[model samples]
Structures are given as structure tokens and as C-alpha cells.
Target: MIVAAWTVCAGTVMPAAADTDPRGYLTKMKAQEMWKVADGTGITVAVIDSGVKDIPGLEGRVLPGMSFMEPPFERPDVSYPPHEDFVGHGTTMTAGIVGDGSAGGPRGLAPGAKVLPIRTSVGTPMAFAVASEAAKGIRYAADNGAKVINLSIGMTQDWPMGKIKPAVEYAQSKGVLIFAAMGNEGEGNNWTNVIAALPGVLGVGAVDEDGQVMPFSSHGPDTDLSAPGGQVLNRCNGNKDWCVGDGGTSYATSLASASAALVWSAHPDWTANQVARVLIQTAGGPVDGAKRSDWVGYGAVRPRKVLLDHEGDPGVPDADPLASPAPAKAPTPSAEQTAAAPRRVESADAESGLSWQWPALGAVVALSLGITVLVKRRRR
Candidate 1:
């Protein structure tokens, strides 16, 4: 069952000379103010990427999830303790979602939230095979009780839309809020891949400490919001010390997912639609005649606004904020609609000033194993 698919790039990690204040992003995003109101106390976020390790920071916070990778591979074990982050990417994402700073490590936005670690990849070596099972992983998360699904992975080309749409719809139908990275090729086409561009998905872009969109953060009309991703610090696998200078829309997606968990935990009665609407309406963005910017999406996500301020209208509770107009009901599908391939362009990974050529396009999708990790001075 090795289906041809795109490779998954591990999130970039640049070592630092000194330990960054793990709460740096939370302070900048004003997450501390919102914590008084809610700390995502009753939420579960699904981390669909490389496996998550049971690190000290994530103790008692990670729930068991299934691994879709084939056996005897890079990450062979697939059992109850699905915490074996091979590339350190998924572990960082999980830490960003639910880390409680229990071990004097980096704290997450939603420290009270639990993480469902669904291993979909074994790092870049098996990216294509891992991507082939992404849709199934999404379905498994939704059915198993994930309130939010965090897909921090992306490809230059859209996965066959037909293969992904139903799974996305299924998750949305089950009241799951999905967030995905817009890609890190902002200097290039910045095309929002199919998964992020899907109607119900919340596509996230990266912003730096100064509240500016990163040059590498992908931009498109499908972008839903922006979050602190550039130079953010997170835990690395097998290391108690934190890794700084990590940048990409992948980290932004996890932060946004944690933001949703915060709001969902505060207002558990609100439907997924209401939560989505609140996030969009309250986001901090430019006012272009009340329209959102293609680069920064609706604006930088401010969970504080949604949690502390309770006066804004959340609009329809069941209506999707990103839904498109319905097509006329038809008994049969149109030939053109069924056969058309999505428009796509190729791009390279430009993280940390290093460039790598990706696999060529074809029926067989392959991802490049060019994850950039600069080993600078170690930070405690």
C-alpha cells in the first residue's frame, strides 16, 4: 500500500547561543492575559506529522495515536506510546501546542490542552509514503475525538484534491477545526497548497517578533490568519535544551491550532463555526475596505481578543466562515470537473538562507530530504 505522494519537509531548526525565554511568543501575543480567562483547559489537538516524543515538557499531556507509516521503516514502532519524534519536527510542534513548562522547558499557548500524536511521516526519507496516508490520518483523528487537527506539513503541489476533500469534509462535519501551513515559499509562488486552500481549513502564515509577515511565509487568498513563527523557540528531540531561530508556517499552524483550543476551551458550547468566525472577525489585520490581505490573511491571530473580550458578534453558529457558494445540484458529475488537475507551480525550500532542489513533478510524488538544521552554540 505504498501510494506515490509528495515528501514532507521537516521544520527548520537553528541552534542558538543562549536559551530564549520560552514564553517569548506568549508574551508578544498577549497570551498571558487570556490565560486568566482560559488556558485551553479542555481541548485536544491532533499533531499530524512525525511522531511526538514524551519529553519532560510534554509529560501527561500527550495521548496515544496511530502511526500510518509502514513497518521496518525509519520509524517502525506503531503502538500505544506513539511518542518517537524521528526528525524533532513533530515534537517541537507538540510542545508548541500543549507544553506546560513542567520541566522548566518551553511553555505552549494551550498548556492545558492534550495532544493526540498521529505519526504520519518518518522524517523526509519517507515523506512521500507518509503523505499518501495523510487523509486517512485526518479521518482517524476526527473519529477518535480531536477537537482541532494541526497539519503543519505542506507541499508545493496540491495533493489530488479528490483524495483529500472528503477527508477534510469529514473532519469538519465532526466539529473539528483544521489548520495547515501555507508553505514556506513566499519568495517564490507562495501558492497555498490544496490542503490549506480547502474551504473549511484555516490556512496560517508566519509572522516575526515585530509583528511583520516573514518574507518566507506563503501568501494567497486562501490564507486565514498569521501567527508568531519566525525565530520562535521550541524543544528538540533527545535534548532538554530548547532550540531557537525556528521559522516556517509549520510553527505558525501549531500556534494557531493552540489558539483555537484556547477559545474552544473557554467557550465549549460554541460550535466550530462560531469559533472560526470569532477568530477571523477579531484578528488583527489591515482594513482594506473590510477585506483581508492575501499576504497576512485576515490578520495576525489574537486569541486574547476572543477570550478576554466577550462583546463581539460571532455570526452564525453553524455557518462556515470560508464556505463558497454552492453549485447547482446535479445528478451526475461533469467531465471537466472530474478530470481537471489543480493549477500548480514548483518551488524550493529557502529556510535559513539555504536552498535545496525538490523532487520533480510526476504521477509519483517525492519530497526532498534537505531539512536544514544549523548547529550553533547550544542553549540550555
Candidate 2:
């Protein structure tokens, strides 16, 4: 039941060129132009992670949310502002979705979207005891009007998929889009965590400014999309200044969620499946033919292509994008089966592990400065 936040930090400060726009991923993804069409005006994205802080960049955008952390660790109520970010991970994820960039602060992909923060213990000593909280959080978000649910955390221990399937099904049934991070374990085998492997979730991977899949980004069959995650900038804990060296599939998950918001806001009538289809079809990859790869899934998310050019066919609005014929009954994995799976390393910094070399592809590189990568450690 132990869960870990999937984020990494770069030890160095942001490069001088990144100062022009701390959130350079927006420009690279053509988000600025898309904003003219749709700025996620009426959407609400649920950030289910550690917790979201009410910073100036996020300001009034953060709504009251519930915390499953318990006792003195828990907040007042669901109406209470979730301003307790123990590791700054949730705040960074929130900034990726809703930062207004006012006063030269970090700008989000969906600056106009509202955030519903649901705090869970994704990276704490008590994480193992609160696994069911994630499932409850998803159901709560869907019932309370969350259009998109972003889970920037993953379980480090092997838990029964059944524990979360019902909640995931409930969210999908309510027309909510869910995105989870493909863990930052590279090819280390811990990347395809249970949440990422689920049928109804869109598993996201990380790519650098160059659009190259980061060496540390997880790769597996479950990865549904890729986004700018390497060396991305976000707010630091208890500080409004941008933390320039943070990167991981966690950031990519937030960006992908925001991209969904932009598309949904623009086409209010489109179903979650249709929005997902558009993202998959319009994604920019190494080659048009190689749209789905183990490394980057359906390729780098290009919301602008979907928003500006009105590209791609959003096939079957009501169809589930990740649906397979429902098994007679979903088979639950045995404890032994779960244990056999590669468990994530438990560490304070989840992405600071040994680097795996990935094949380099020639692509246009964008210069965006900001964070160091921290690797997560395994629980004993």
C-alpha cells in the first residue's frame, strides 16, 4: 500500500534562456496560441496527490478539498483549503495545471481551470496504511464534479488491482478522464505500476524539451501519452519562486491533464473518450507510422494541433479509449503475483536512481530551464 510521489529534481539552477518563460513547455506545446481559443474556462481538474498549497500563482483557483491523511495530519473538512504540501510535490503538480503566471510566475497549461485538491499520503511513513484512500479520493472527485483526475503518485508496494478497479470504473462511468504517471523507473521494471496498468487510466510518460523520451522516464505497454516533464519549472515548498530543476512523469501527468482540460473546455460537448482520441491522434511522434511506442506511447501531447488546426478524428465519443472486451470477471492478482512484480525503490526523491540510456532521436529542441531529479527508495 505504500505509494510514492513521482518527481525528480535537477541539482543545477535554470539556464539563463529559460527566464524568458519559466513554463517553456507551454510555448513548445503551442499552448499560448491555444489559449486564445480555450483556456480551460469551465473545467475542474482534481489533483489527487500529497496536497495543494494556495500560492499567489494558484491563488483563488484552488478549491476546498478533503485530506485522507487522518488525525492531526488531516485538514478540517472537504470545504477546507488543502494548503498542506509536505514535500511540495502536489503544489508543483497544481502549478502545472493552474498557475496564472501573474507577476512573472509559473504559467499553467490551463490557467483558467479550477483545481480540486485531494490530499493523500503518497510519500510518507504512513503511506502503506492509506492505499484505499486513493480509491476513495477518485470516487469523491468524480461525484463532486471533477472532469479530470490527475494522480501524480503511484504505489511502491504491490496491491490488489481490485482495490482500485471499482473506483476507477466509477469515475469513467461518470465521464471523468483520469491520468496517472508511468513511474520514473525507466526500464527498471517498476515503471508499470498498478494504476498505470489499469484499463481506464491514461498512463503518461516524460519527455525532455527536445521531445526526446527522458532516460529516467518509465516505458511500458500501458503508457498512453507523453508530455514535457524533464527539467520543468514549478513552485517550491513554502516559496512562490519557481523550482526550476523538477522533472518526471509526474509533471507530464499534470500537463497531460491540463491538455485534456483545454480540449474539453473548447469542445464542451465532447466526451472524455473523444478528447482522449483527439490527443492520441494529434500527438507528435518520431514518425507518423510509429504513433504508439513503448517509450512515448502515442507520442508527445500536442494540444495545439487538436485545438488550433482541429486535427484528428475523435472517433466514437462514448467509446472508452482504453477499453478491451470485459473479461467474464476481472481476475484479481494473488499476493504472490503482486509480490513478484518489480517494486519501486523507496526514497525521499523518487526519480534519482541509476540512469538508463535510451535511443536518441533527432528532434527540434526547446530550451526551458528549471529542477534536479530525486530518486525514490524502496520500503523495507
Candidate 3:
């Protein structure tokens, strides 16, 4: 039985037992569901958060990533890079999304997937840094070959999602599926968070094992899907030995990313929209018509539906998901806007040609070694 009055996000799961740890749960779940075909074997997930460390369990699994904070904290997990997970929040997100247990840690929903760890935010104390730096990291991740993006951070800016929006747009054009977390103020429903509100983002919500929406989880038209959240479970404070009580839409977003990986891995040719639509269309419901509810969006995502039904049609590759034809007259970027952007920030997908593969990324991760890397001065 779940705890009442406790509100958490959906897609969150309980930690594993002593012998059957998170890694074991992942293995069992994958085996039980025959998810190896969609275990995200060769895909790359860009985890945008406080950044990810290449833990021993995930050795040779990580590629180079950029940071937005100021110096002393801008690099990826180098020898001296930020070793002690500053908040320890990002690591939890990483493990939940892509952990393929080699150690005693928990296995991720898409254990076979590789992760691109990028830092975009610090906390409420550094909102500005988070916003600006997240924008930079967004562009940097897209510039490389991140086919799927997972961002658990929220923004305070109210301006139309700005730089991150453009980067997401370009990524979509290049066939990347992006997932973001809705704000964690659903009880009050504040309107400041932009991470989940941006168009083209798979904004996720938090639900429990019983599928009740967490009171603290944010709700809006933006939250298109729900995942395990309230009174949730995962590596407690990065200690796989004891799972911690979890909440918030951040973790749910990561799971949504993992789900995208599963779908994408199954149908590599589908456009990002088709992958997203399959998840939404096949989601578990208390749903009614075409319109979705504000609390749970289309409904709780049951990836098992896709794993079983298996009749998804993602439309043509050239067809834009949002637009009918991607109007030719769409506003082009200004000199300043384009100048501030990093090289390949808009996705040179055709040029990059980095097709994701579990064991094959060794060469791409090497080639992407010296590519665009932006380290922010602060955590913002």
C-alpha cells in the first residue's frame, strides 16, 4: 500500500532488495517483458541536469558532455571533475534512465542505452545561471549526436522558452526525441517553470504505484504524460544500498526519456513525433476523446502497450510533426542569435552521421571526443 497525503511523480519505482537490487529489477523486468529488442541498446540519451559521473558500473558507457556553469565545474567527469554529486539528484536521474548494472547499483529501465551527461542547472539559488547555462548545454548536446534528450531541470524565466526552444526545434528537425519534467509545484500550480512548458517537449508528470497524482507535482497542458513519481523509489542519495523516498517530475522525465529510447530502438526510422505519439496514443487511460486531462495528460504511460500491440505508424520522415509542411517563411535567426549559438548547435545530423549502437558508439564517442563542449561559469 502506498502512503496517502504523499505526493510524488509517476514512472518512479521502488529500489531493489539486497540480492535483487536495482540492477536485478531491471534485468528481471527486461527479461519478463522481452524488452531487449527495445532496451535502447545502441541509442544515446543526453541527461541534462547537474551532470553525470561515469561510475564504474557504466564504464566505457559515457561519452564527453558539456557544462554551463563557470570554471572549476565546467568539465565532464574528468579525473578532477565534480566527483561528489553536488546535489546527487542528477545521478539518480542518470541511473533511473540508463543504468545497466555492472555494480550493485540499480539497473535503468533502458539499461542498454548509453548516456550523454550534460549539466544545465544547480538550484533555486542559481536560477539565472541555470537558465543561461541550460540553454548552452541544450545547444551543445544537439550539436553532437544526442538522438534522445532528457532534462530534469526547471527554469524561472517566463520569456517564451527562448534559446532552449530554438535548440529543441532544431533537434526535432534532426529527428531527436526530447523529454522534460514538469515543475514540482502542482499543489499551487505556479507558472514560472519553463522546462516542461516548451513546445515539442515530452513534458512528464509524477504518479505512484497506484497511479494517483502527487499533490506537489505540477499540472498543465504541458504535462503530456505521467510516470511514477510520488512517494517514489530509486538509489537513495546515490547510495544503492538504501533507496530513498522520491518525488518531483524530474525523475519522471528521465523515465519518459528511457521509454522514448525503447520506442526509438524498436523503430529507428520513425520521426520523433511518431515515437512520442505512440507513447501518448497507447498510454493507459481514464482518457476520453482526443483531448487530454491536465492532471495526467493522455494517461499513465504503459510502454508495455507498445511492446505488445506493435502496430505504430510514425508517418513520413520528411513530414514535420508540428507543422504540416514546416512553412518555408518561418523566421530565420538573427545575426546575434545565430552568432551566440555554437557551431553545429542547430544539428548537422546529416553531417554527423552518428547512428547509435550499444557497442558501436566506441568509435563515435571517440570521434565526438573533441566536438563542441561548453562549460558554464555557474550552475544556472
Model 3 worst lDDT window (10 residues): 356-365
Decoy 3 TM-score against native: 0.71
In model 2, the Cα lDDT at residue 297 comes to 73
Instruction: Please tell me which model should have the higher TM-score, number 1 or number 2.
Output: 2
Off by over 4 Å in 3: 1-31, 72-84, 101-104, 124-127, 234-242, 287-291, 318-380
TM-score of each: 0.79, 0.79, 0.71
Tens-place lDDT per residue, model 2, 89-195, is 78888888998876445688999899999987555544543457788889999999899999887653344345676788899889999998877777454435557
Best by lDDT: 2
Candidate 1 runs further than 4 Å off: 1-22, 72-81, 102-104, 122-124, 235-241, 287-290, 324-380
lDDT of 1 at 344: 35
lDDT per residue, candidate 3, 1-380, as tens digits? Answer: 00011222222334444332223323323334747457877788887666665565566666677666544344545432422345546666777776665555545777777888776435323334555566776677778888898877664344425566677777766677777776565544233245556556767876654455655566665667777653434444433333534546776677778888887887777777777767765555442333355666665665655775664445655543333332222222211111111122124542353211111100111222322212111100
Q: What shift in Å separates residue 168 of candidate 1 from its native position after superposition?
A: 0.8
In terms of lDDT, model 3 sits at 0.56
Model 2: runs farther than 4 Å from truth?
13-21, 72-81, 187-190, 237-241, 324-380
TM-score: model 2 vs. ground truth: 0.79
Q: Model 2: how far is 7 from its true place, Å?
A: 2.8
Q: In candidate 2, what residue range of length 10 has the lowest lDDT sum?
A: 332-341
